[model samples]
Structures are given as C-alpha cells and as structure tokens.
Target: MTDKVSEAEFLQGLIPQLRSEGYEVYLHPTAPVVPPFLADLRPDAIAIGKGKKLVIELVTSESTQQKKTRALANLIKEHPDWELRVLVVTSASRGNELQVQSREQIQNFLDEIKLLQDSNHVSAAFILGWATFEAIARRLMTATFEKPQTPGRIVQQLAQEGYVTPSEGDFLRILAAKRNALIHGNLHDLPQKGEVEFFREISERLAAESAAA
Candidate 1:
C-alpha cells in the first residue's frame, strides 16, 4: 500500500505474497528466464501462473521515458496472457549503517530454530532458520550496498563482500527457493536437519560479526 519503500524492497516483498497465490516469480528475466515469446522484452519482474503472466514495471521519477513505458504497456495490452502492473516509486533506498537485531535477540531466535529442529518440527525449524538468515543478512546488506536487496541477492552479496564463502552463498541460494516454498506451505519434505543447522550457524556467525563491524 505504501510506495515509500525502494523498488527493490517492494519487489522483494511481492515475491512471497505472489508465491503464496501459486505464482512463479522471475526477477529481471533475461533470455533464458522467460520463454521465447517474451525473449525480446525485459520486465522488472515476471510472475507466471497457469494461464497468465504478470509483467511488473517499477517507475521512479527518473525512470525510462514515458514513451517507452507506454510502448511496453501497449504491447502487453495486445496479449491476453500478459498484464502490466506499474509501481510508481517516490524514492530509492540509500542503505543503512545499522543492524536490525541485537546479539541477544538473534541468539534467542537461533535457539528457537534449534528447539524446533530437535522437537521433530524440522519444517518449522527450516523455515525459521531462513528467517534468521534474512534478519542478519539484511543488516549486512544495508551496511554494504546502496539498495535493499531480496534474500536471494543478500546471499550473493554476502559472498561477494567476503562475509561468506562462495560455496556457502551457492548453497544458500538453493535454500532460498526452498524457503519460499516452505513459507507458502508448498514444500512437501523438510530439508535435512544438518542443512538447517548449517544455515543457522552461518546466520549466527554473521549476526555477531556484523554487529561487531
């Protein structure tokens, strides 16, 4: 309802809500991301469903000219399967220099994740584990980058900034998708307990060091 958030944050928030409605979201799709029908065009984000595809465009004050925007809008209007949703953003994120959680608070959440895991609520544990990752990763990301990023981007940025290794980043990216499914109740099987523990450990360490920095 608020356009005060940056386009990145706005897009990030839509992803989960869209997934909950059975949509498959693709961010900044390129040739390989979309089928040949949309190969020549790029949307800020794409949400595909059984018989429809939503083409999302974020318009800032200094965004692409109105002519281009109109063209894209008109092009989509001709297609029955596509619909355009434009987001008019008033401002962009400039990043933050602060962490979102206290060390004690993060530790408490970590413990809760573990408790759920040990109690055979592994699905809940894994879901909570990723939420923990987001809290810490957001802190690191706001401090390091100029814009707010999604969980997928946060993991990549953490690796790029040397906060986590390349392998850790790769694994986290895969988990991020599963996390989406878990959050939306589409996941059938819980991830391995060891995998959840690894994610928890990484987040725990990141929160400590990020706060220290």
Candidate 2:
C-alpha cells in the first residue's frame, strides 16, 4: 500500500476542492485577537461562496487538538456569520484515540456554531478531517443519487421494482462501512482480499441497478 499523504499537502489540495464544490473556504493560521483586545483576526484561508463561509485551520504537528481549539476560539470572535464550518487536517498517525478526542472537541465547536445559528448569525456547521475526503465524497455522491429527481434514485427504484434480494442492500451497506473505515484512518487491519471482493461486488450491483432502471 502507498504511504499516506502529508496533512499539509492534503489541506492545500482540499481548499480548491471545496471551492470547486461551491463552498467558500478560509484558512486561519493564527489567533485573531487577545481576549482583552479588539482586532480583526486574520485566518489562514477563507473562501466565501454558495451563500455560506467555511474557515479552515490546518495543523501538521502532534499538538493538533490544541491548535484546533485555539483556532476555533478565534474564528468565533472574528466571523459573525452563523453558518461557519471548520475543517481539521492532521496525520493518521495521531491514532484512533486522538481521533475520538478530536471528535469530542469538534462536538463542542459545533455547539458554538449552533449557538450562532440560533441567533441568526449562521446557517449550519461542518467539521471534516482531511483524511476523510474520499469517504466524504462518496457520501456526497450517494446523497446526490438519493435525491428525488436524480438518476440514482431511479436506479434504486428499479431495483425495488425487480424485487432484488435484500442481501444486495446489505452488501452495499457493508461496502459503505469499509469505505468509512478507510476514510476514518482505521483500515490498518482491513483484509486486502475481502476489500477487493467487496468492491467488485458493489460495482456489479451498481451496474445492474442502473441497467434495471
């Protein structure tokens, strides 16, 4: 298997991806102001589009959690828009323990964002890790397919029309779980042969669903 990409490069590439996907993104590298002072906090990167804004803070060091907390504090102070989103980019070596810890931290951050939204300062909030890009992409694609008027929904409807086996649906769910594991940086124990077979099966099922539709 290939070595994981560095977090810095991943964030760099991810910024444009977000832009292309119609999200406004910003990078905040330093805290904007001291608690007792009033000043405009400069973020590392900021993109504004799609009627919303996203603030990104990239950390490559072992102290990623600390850095994220600090950046989030500054973002709350500087941005008045209630619909702010945050992205945390770090290496997989940080391990699952750290990942769980980060999720807790992100939950708190989401709470703050929701407060802003409740006050009509923003619309929504999101927290994403750079390592989870592929998984996120899959989810976005699936959402698109599931939309009422999309071809994906049509394919699913056709599958139901043909009374496809419930096991087929179970297999798709399993594939999604495996993809989720890989995206969350928890695939170190994944069996290579099983993954290959699962992918092949999913591909064939998807094709059949499309044909039936």
Candidate 3:
C-alpha cells in the first residue's frame, strides 16, 4: 500500500487483487447488506467467495483497539462463515501477535478436542473441532497473499488441488453450514456424536502431518 493513498483509495486498490482471487469484492456503498446484528457496524467492504463472507475492516493501529473494532470482532466471532479481516495500513502497533505453538502444545489441543467429545460437550467439541480443522488448514496450506486468506478460501483451494478429497471437503462444508446456524444465538441445534468424532479424527490426522512436515 502506498503511504500517499487514502483509506478509500487503498481499499479500491485491493479490488482487482481480491477479484482475481475469485472473491466477488463489493466496495462500500450507501448501504452494504450485512447481518441485522451488524447493520450498524458495516465494514469497509464485504468479500464473498468460496462459501465465506469476509467482513473487511480498514483500520489504523490506534483504531484497532477501539470499542467499535472490539465489538465487531466479538459480534463476528460466532459465525463460522464470517470472518473479520483487520487490514492495518500502519506498522506502528506491535507487529503480528499470532502465537507459535510447539508440537506438544498442538498435541494438547488435539487431546482437549477429543476430551470435549468424550465428555459429551458436543457444542464445545464441534466449535473447537472446526476451529482446529481451520487452524490446521492455515498451517498446512501453501497459498499466500499480501493479507492472510480466510480458512474457507484456504480449504477451497486445497480441495481444488486434490490436497483434500472431495468427500472430505464436502463433509466439512456441511459441518460449517450447521455450525453457522449453531452460532447465530442458536444452541438447540447441535452435531451428532459421529460428526464430532469425525472432526476429532480429521484434526488429529492433519496435526500429525503438520508436525511431520
């Protein structure tokens, strides 16, 4: 991003790149159609592709910590298909705070996921299990961009290239759709025991491969 460009210009600049990557990028208009809960907190743009809805927010380092930003993250947290991509044009804040987990730490997380399933915490297991699957996809994926790609995009690319089997990819997408419902303030709907266990199996396999690599 050129330092001379304004936020709008900066965002407009990304449209071609985003579109080329298969995202149907929609720049801000008078009214962007977001969920009712997030109607007031409309993002700078919304990118839809690969079965995902990305809430793209352009923020400076200082504004990243503001109340609205925090609210945006919290509100978007529950939805599996939605992600908040914070594009910080400035480098003033502490750089990427993503933590690195050791092999043992990764194993612990895998164990916790299975434990959740064994304890009959299906909701917790399903959510964490999906997150773990997404996390593994992020680490194992070879694709790169100026910004981090959302998990849906990552999985889609992998599935396209045969890194993930069609059946596996389809199953995950079904679970993801079910998960979207579970998060929108709906707790009554939950995945079955077999589904949660399947997540555990996939997560463990991916974790092992990642560790080996």
Let me know the TM-score candidate 3 reaches against the reference structure.
0.50
How much lDDT does candidate 1 score? 0.66
Which candidate achieves the best lDDT against the true structure?
A: 1
Q: What's the distance in Å from true for residue 184, model 3? A: 1.8
List lDDT for all candidates, in order.
Answer: 0.66, 0.40, 0.63
Task: Point out where model 3 deviates above 4 Å.
Answer: 1-100, 142-151
TM-score of each: 0.50, 0.33, 0.50
Please count the clashing residue pairs in each candidate, in the order shown.
Answer: 0, 18, 0
lDDT tens readout by residue for model 3, 1-213? 333256777788878877876888877733536776685776778888898777776644223233554566667666767766555443323333333344565565566556545545456557656555655665565333223444466568768867568898887777777777774545566799898898678778777877777
32-104: candidate 1 lDDT, tens digit per residue: 6555555466777889988877777665433433444455555654576776655544444433323365556
Q: What is the C-alpha local distance difference test score of candidate 3?
A: 0.63
Better of 1 and 3 by lDDT: 1
**Candidate 3 Cα RMSD (Å):** 11.9
